[model samples]
Target: MDAAVAAIEESGPSGWSLRELARRAGVSHAAPAHHFGDKTGLLTALAAEGFGLLADALTAAGDGLLDLGVAYVRFAVRHRAYFEVMFRPELYRPDDPELTAARTRADELLGDAVRPLSPEPEAALAAWSIAHGFAGLWLSGALPPEVGTDPEAAARPVLGTLFPYDEDGRPAAEPPRER
Candidate 1:
């Protein structure tokens, strides 16, 4: 797994080959195929691992949507290789069982984290979209350099407005809208 991570990080989804991976790990060229079946299999495993890490990090952050956003950016920075493949379904097999399970687990984690703050089911989806959008912006270098200096800190003020919170730091209830 470490070898796969290293190769993906250094090159990208398409850059690494099984032979080079075997060379780095001091194993025969067939070793990776035996373990992962192929490049897609390897990437699927990597995405699963990445999703697990994301779940743990988001759970630990405890800042609700804000913390989840921070964790998303942190995950990208911390696991650039995994992050690169986790979202690129074309790079690997989308139907892989492990990848499917991992994607489900990650989505569930996001749902659990955002559900409480949402007044309606759609609200949870909206919250997740916003958080993910912010994280994507950060990962894509769209945020200003100062924002990147301390991503969490810089993002807080903007995200705070997007997801209103009370003085206690919990998300505030949404107000009534026009009928």
Candidate 2:
């Protein structure tokens, strides 16, 4: 899996092939195909792994939805290949069970993160849409170039708009304050 991720990172998703993944893994050329069935299968598994990581990160951030947003953006920037594969259904088989499960889990995690606000689905969607849009924009360089220079600093204001915050810079309406 690490080999697959490294290959995708080094050469983009288009360059990732089962043979190349097997070669990187020091396995037979057919090894990846045997295990994954094909490139799409491998990508589905990869997306699942990425979403699992995302779910964990979101859970860890607890009521700090702003931090969760930051973590998400950071994850995307750091795992460009996996993030793209996870979100861009056209690039892979969306019907794959692994991909479907991953997507569901990811959404559940996001829902949990936004639940504290008692937001209606529309509000939750809006908050998620903004965060997702910002992350996508940051990854695509659609945001100011300087934003990348210090992503956390640049994103704080935008996150503040999307995240409920008290006057003291802490997440509002959360107690025990830890999720």
After TM-score superposition, the amount by which residue 46's alpha carbon in candidate 2 deviates from its true location, in angstroms, is: 0.4
Give the top-scoring candidate (lDDT). Answer: 1
Off by over 4 Å in 1: 119-121, 173-179
What C-alpha RMSD separates each model from the true structure?
A: 2.5, 4.6
Q: Per-residue alpha-carbon lDDT of model 1 for 59-126, expressed as tens digits?
A: 78775676676677677777788888888888788887777887777777777767766547686676
CA lDDT of each candidate?
0.76, 0.74
- What is the model-wide C-alpha lDDT for candidate 1? 0.76
Best by TM-score: 1
- For candidate 1, the 10 contiguous residues with the lowest summed lDDT are 170-179
lDDT of 2 by residue, 60-176 (tens): 765566777777777777777788777766667778777678778878777766777755676568667877788788877888766657666677678778666876545677532
Candidate 1 accuracy as TM-score: 0.85
Per-model TM-score versus the true fold? 0.85, 0.83
- Error at 59, model 1, angstroms: 1.9
